[model samples]
Target: MSELLDNTEAATKAVVDWLTKKAKTKSKFYIKDFYKIFPDDKPRAIKKVVNKMVETGELEFWSSGSTTMYGLKGGGIQHSSEGES
Candidate 1:
């Protein structure tokens, strides 16, 4: 059970890391971009992870008219405690 949780955490961190890197130059990205990076996961799964990240203040979302975009809460890159780059 602990292993399962660890794997989930790692996956979530990967998504966050990717978004953080992108946010450096791009002001925002669609949730679908995350789907591309993590093709193994379903959209619903990705949304769940993204929601959690937003809730934890690791990410932020914005809406431009009808389009929505997402980015890291902080402007700088955020590394996982495990030293993931």
Candidate 2:
């Protein structure tokens, strides 16, 4: 419905703002980090918004082989798989 879309859009903007303004010094974040931003919302709902951002090209995935992270697209330390063991 239109209400659902509006809420999702608002959440998406809140996340983008947090990444750009509040957590500006950090490049990557964990899913748990977003819990602090939307304490009233269910974790599943938050994940939905974040994953949507990834699908929309607003964020990108970062991995260190063992762990996965999220960061603003083109705004964090570049990851290269060229020289790895």
Best-fitting candidate, scored by TM-score: 2
RMSD of each: 9.0, 3.6
Compute the lDDT of residue 4 as modeled in candidate 2: 38
Clash-forming residue pairs, model 1: none
For candidate 1, give the lDDT.
Answer: 0.69
Clash tally for model 1: 0
* Residue 11 in candidate 1, Cα distance off native in Å: 2.0
The true-structure Cα RMSD of candidate 1 reads 9.0
Off by over 4 Å in 1: 1-6, 76-85
Task: Give the per-residue lDDT of model 2 (tens digit) for 1-85.
Answer: 2243349777787888889885568878988898777877778877878899999999887877998888788776564433577
- Least accurate 10 contiguous residues by lDDT in model 2: 76-85
List the candidates' TM-scores in order.
0.69, 0.79
User: Please, what are the lDDT tens digits per residue for candidate 1 over residues 1-85?
Assistant: 2232237678677876776676658756788887876676668877777778789887777766898777777443332222554
